[model samples]
Target: MNDNNKDDKTLNHSRRQFFKISTALTAVALTPSYILKAADDNMDDKIAELFEKRDLNIEVNGIVHTLSIEPRVTLLDLLREQLKLTGSKKGCDHGQCGACTVHVNGQRVLSCLSLAIMQDGKKITTIEGLAKGDELHPMQAAFIKHDGFQCGYCTPGQIMSAVACVREGHANNEDEIRSYMAGNICRCGAYPNIVDAITEVKQKGGTI
Candidate 1:
């Protein structure tokens, strides 16, 4: 080939390579900035809005706690996230599952469905508050003795419901107990032991 033709081809190739490198470097430099901006936007949206944070005063496990909480925060989230009492599980945040069940003013309530603001001035009792100084309640002891749980994910709710069931006179018989506890589904299929635990607690005149 002629020298001039060869030189022209080399120049074109060099220009192509330079353009490719420049494009790639521009993309790489812009990627992190775009990602950072998206992350910042997400953080801003997640920041609890000023007006949403409202003052909350409630008695939890016999202790009165006062703090500001988001209006959208559920009672379960308030206990687990704000107060750091994680004994209540977050199964089925829509209240279909009873893992988040707790006692509100001595009544069994689905914490996941109840709002923190709605529970103001109410007494809240979680699994952590069920026992008294190394002494398990009769229902808890009965559950342990009867082996009422396998994975134990739903045990807290089951126990809590059992206590309330007895208190509400719903534990008249095995069928009654089972029917009343139907709301708290135990995935482990420990229904028999759960009934036995409830029966034992009832026989002992135990009240939660």
Candidate 2:
């Protein structure tokens, strides 16, 4: 009788082990298909995304550049990251501060808001391009002479907008200069000096 009892216990243990193994196999087989693909195929998708760039041809400062870049890349990133032009500041990248200002096709634009992919065959001018060899642009010289910048982080944008303001013939008076240059924000309260610089340049009346 004791032998039969021991045999019954052994049979029950074998059945339990079999059921546990079967349950585990069934669970694995029933896993969602998307989960399986995410574990293995998603990595390949990310790798492919890294190479997903389109051809871009644009001019910077004065030199033409042909590059392949992702469509999401902004003009500011293309200049600062790829072309190594760091003069354009990235303050308030929401197009409010105007720090990332640059000339796009002879018009002032916020680089942070402009996409690199859409600027094909366009001319872009940054703060670094505002000067000749060993000579400053008239606006730049006036800014220096009048002390237009205090912290200097907003200087580039200010100068770009100032040039545009003068070019647009909106720098006729102090009020108009302030109104036209209102897009740029200088934290150091250098408005008077900036107005002076723009006024001086406008009075000179030469090509900026």
Q: TM-score each candidate.
A: 0.75, 0.77
Across residues 51-164, which tens digit of lDDT does each residue of candidate 2 receive? 356668899989999786888899999999999999999998899998999999999999999999999999999999999988999999999999999999999999999999
lDDT of each: 0.82, 0.86
User: Which candidate number would show the highest lDDT if scored against the true structure?
Assistant: 2
Any idea what lDDT model 1 has?
Answer: 0.82
The parts of candidate 1 lying over 4 Å away from their true place are: 1-50
Give each model's clash number.
Answer: 0, 0
Model 1, 114-195: lDDT tens digits are: 9999998899999889899899988999999999999999888888888899999999899999999988988889999999
Off by over 4 Å in 2: 1-51
The count of backbone overlaps in candidate 2 is 0
Residue pairs with clashing backbones, model 1: none
Model 2 residue 188 lDDT score: 97
State the displacement of the C-alpha of residue 148, model 1, in Å, after optimal TM-score superposition: 0.5
